[model samples]
Target: MNRKSIAVDMDEVLADTFKKIVKTANDICNLSLSEVDVKGNRIWDFINKEQAKELRKAINTPGFFRDLEVIDSAVFAVKELSKHYDIYIATAAMEAPNSFHDKYEWLMEHFPFLDPRYFIFCGNKKVVHADYLIDDTVSQLDAFTGEGILFKANHNENTVTNHIQVDSWNEVLTLFSSLRVV
Candidate 1:
């Protein structure tokens, strides 16, 4: 099989970013929010603009990135995919400049095996080129010409149209294998 380039979104797909954000928000605001409640909802859904700003501030607290965790099967999946494709981390994160940098730093600290060149920070991923784009956003899926595999999670149910949806990283590996032959 020829080597193909794959682009992957960072936050939800690769790292448990949303989870940490919610936990930070709840801790800061003294609010009780379950993971189920935050799933499938946009950032604005649970918190207002002001609250969102506060959440971003909370993330800046020392050791936040050090404590961050990877999603289930993410490390193994990336390790396996690296053998066949040049994996790039493409993320849309300009909304909060500081947080974006923090997230990037966090990613680099955790996944040092990934080449720094492959880590791209963009406001719009639609302009990036790759044989495959693995993302959780439905709107982002529409922007790429290559096969867009929607990484299934809560709050992203609107992505059911015109895209391949995989509930697990193992399934993602299978999808790529199938695509390689086609």
Candidate 2:
């Protein structure tokens, strides 16, 4: 069977960006916010506009993307998905200049199972060719040519898009494992 190409996003889908942002907010700006409080694509939506500014600035910091806790079940689920698919880490790191190297290194450290050759760092998701694209950003999903899997993220709770929504890695595993496509 020809393997399907699966393009996965890096930030929220795999990197647990919300947790990092919250930590940064609390650590640097002394702002307390929880996962449920992050309700939109913009940082200001969930935080004090001033503190959100700080969080935004923190993201652009060179090493900010390097260390973050891995989301639950993502590593195992992707490992399993890679077995029957050509999995690629398609991250839109260009928008975040400082994140380029940090994101790459982070992936290298956390998801050592994925071959480095499959890592795609770009400004646009539409340029990527894949059978599926799993991302938290709705705009990326809108641009993808193939099926989009909207990975659940606190920032995107109210996002309404024409994509299949998977709340957890278990759902992804079930969806792919039960596939009969050849």
Candidate 3:
């Protein structure tokens, strides 16, 4: 089989984005958002819209993304996977054009391994066709027709679904390797 084209989500998959957002929110609002509960393959719940708004504001704070930290296993996993497959960072950015540009630039600066061809900032990811998609949102997974892997998050519930669920980047790498063999 040919090398598969993989589209991976940026937030929880590549960076400690959700955690940072939560931390930022706490710092700004003095409110604690519950930890995400990721079960089986679904998110049991998520931060409410009000909290989400606060998190978004935090992300918009000056130099927020610039100082953001990449997830522990993301860089290594992407480097390893890139040797065998085309890895694309497909992210759902803020609706605002300026915010999107800032986020995209931040990603580019932080992850030099990510090429322009592999960086996509879009409002929706379901339409961006790829052989496999690794994402954190179940709704996005539901929109995709091809293989979708749910990168497990704190509030996920192990609900039966067509998508595969993996907790860590290493497991994601292993899953892809197995798929390549078959």
Candidate 4:
């Protein structure tokens, strides 16, 4: 059997993007929004369109994605999964000009085991070719050609009804490690 390539998302799947963004919003905008306050996958659900604009602008400021914390066990889990499957980090780098390099550096710092060659920086996730695509954004997963693993996030927890959901990195390890790609 051929080695199945797994396309993993960088934001909520591996990095704690939502928490950081929420924290930033709270700190800079003086808005008190909890994880439970998030109503959808995008930021607009938590704040007004005008405030969301400010948040969107804030994403590119500096050290936004770069300083984001890693999801619990994400590094170890991906490293372990790499032994079983070909892992490719498929992140949408269109969010900001700095996101590409920031995310790249972040990956290098956190997942040193993963080769830079496996990193795919792109816009549309639908174009990504893989056997499995694990992401927090349901729209991206919905557009992907592969089997979508919905990594749960603060914004996406109450959402996502189509794909198989994995709440944590351990869950990801368990599912991927136990299953055989056919």
Candidate 5:
């Protein structure tokens, strides 16, 4: 029997990019902006234009993606999911061309169990052909042809959508377990 494929996102889904951004902003601007402050809205909208610009600059800088913490239980969940599905780490790397090397190394370090061949770094996530796509971006989910599972993030806290949503990796594993039975 052929296994169904799952395309998992990198930034907010598997990696704690939002937390890193919050820390970066706090360090650069001496502001005490927490994840709670950015909940239900984009980070760019929560801060001033100058602050946003500075945060954007930090994001664009190389080595920024190198030290991001992996989402809790993400590795174990993905490894468990991989036993039944084809797991692909599909990330929109083109948005930050400077992040490619760091992101690649980060994944290799945290997800050594995953085959490098299954990694996909591209401009458009629509290029990913899989049975399911788990991402934090609503726009990417909207454009996806397969079932889109919204992995909850601070920025997307207030997003109301038709797609299935998972707040944690444990929830993800639970949802996929049911899907796998179908």
Candidate 6:
């Protein structure tokens, strides 16, 4: 029997992008920001207009996406899930065209178990064909046709959502495990 498929997002879901973004924003903007400072809000909303503008350019810079730290246990959890479901890396790379290559390279280095053909780089995630989508963005969840699992991120702490929310990879594993049993 064919296994169900899951489309996993790359940014805040599997990658610690906010951590890198905060560091980049601080280095270039000469500001001291921490997870506490940006909690429950977007970095752009938390910082001043000038800082946001600079951050926008800095993030768009080539190599920004190359060395981002992976989310804790993301590799192990995704690998476990892959045993039961076809895993696909779905990223909104069109927003930053420069991230396409870097993100691909990063995935290749980190998630070598996943086939490169499963990597998706696109603007609208609504086009993704899968049984489930694990993402941190509400818009993407809303667009997805299947079950949406919202991976908790600092910016989405207070987000009101009907979809299931997982605070960590362990939670994600537990949730999927339950789904498999059902």
**Which candidate should be chosen as best, given lDDT against the real structure?**
6
lDDT of each: 0.78, 0.85, 0.72, 0.86, 0.91, 0.92
State the lDDT of candidate 6 residue by residue for 40-129, as single tens digits.
998787678888888888888899999999999999999999999999999999988888889999999999999999999988899999
Deviation from native of the Cα of residue 52 in model 4, angstroms: 2.0
TM-score of each: 0.85, 0.90, 0.80, 0.91, 0.95, 0.96
What TM-score would candidate 4 get against the native?
0.91
Q: For residue 83, give model 6's deviation from the true position in Å.
A: 0.7
Local accuracy of candidate 2 as per-residue lDDT tens digits, 1-182: 67888999988888887787777777877667666665665556556777766777788899988987788899999898988899999999887788988999999998999999999999879999999999998888998899999998887887888799999889989988777475
Compare candidates 2 and 6 on lDDT and give the better one.
Answer: 6
Error of 6 at 133 (Å): 0.3
Clashes of 2: 0
Candidate 5 lDDT over 107-171, as tens digits, reads 99999999999999987788889999999998998888899999999888889999999999999
Question: Which candidate achieves the best TM-score against the true structure?
Answer: 6
CA RMSD, predictions in order: 2.5, 2.0, 3.6, 1.9, 1.3, 1.2
Q: Point out the higher-scoring one by lDDT: 3 or 5.
A: 5
The digit string of per-residue lDDT tens for model 4 on 31-90 reads 887766765655566577777778888887767888888889998899888998899999
- Preferred candidate (lDDT higher): 4 or 5: 5
Candidate 2 is scored at a TM of: 0.90
Which tens-of-lDDT digit does each residue in 19-76 have in candidate 1?
7777788887777998787766765587777887787776655556555678789888
Q: Given candidate 4, what's the lDDT at residue 45?
A: 61
Global lDDT of model 6: 0.92
Q: Stretches of candidate 4 above 4 Å error?
A: 39-42
Worst 10 residues of 1 by lDDT: 93-102
How close to the true structure is residue 167 of candidate 5, measured as C-alpha lDDT?
A: 97
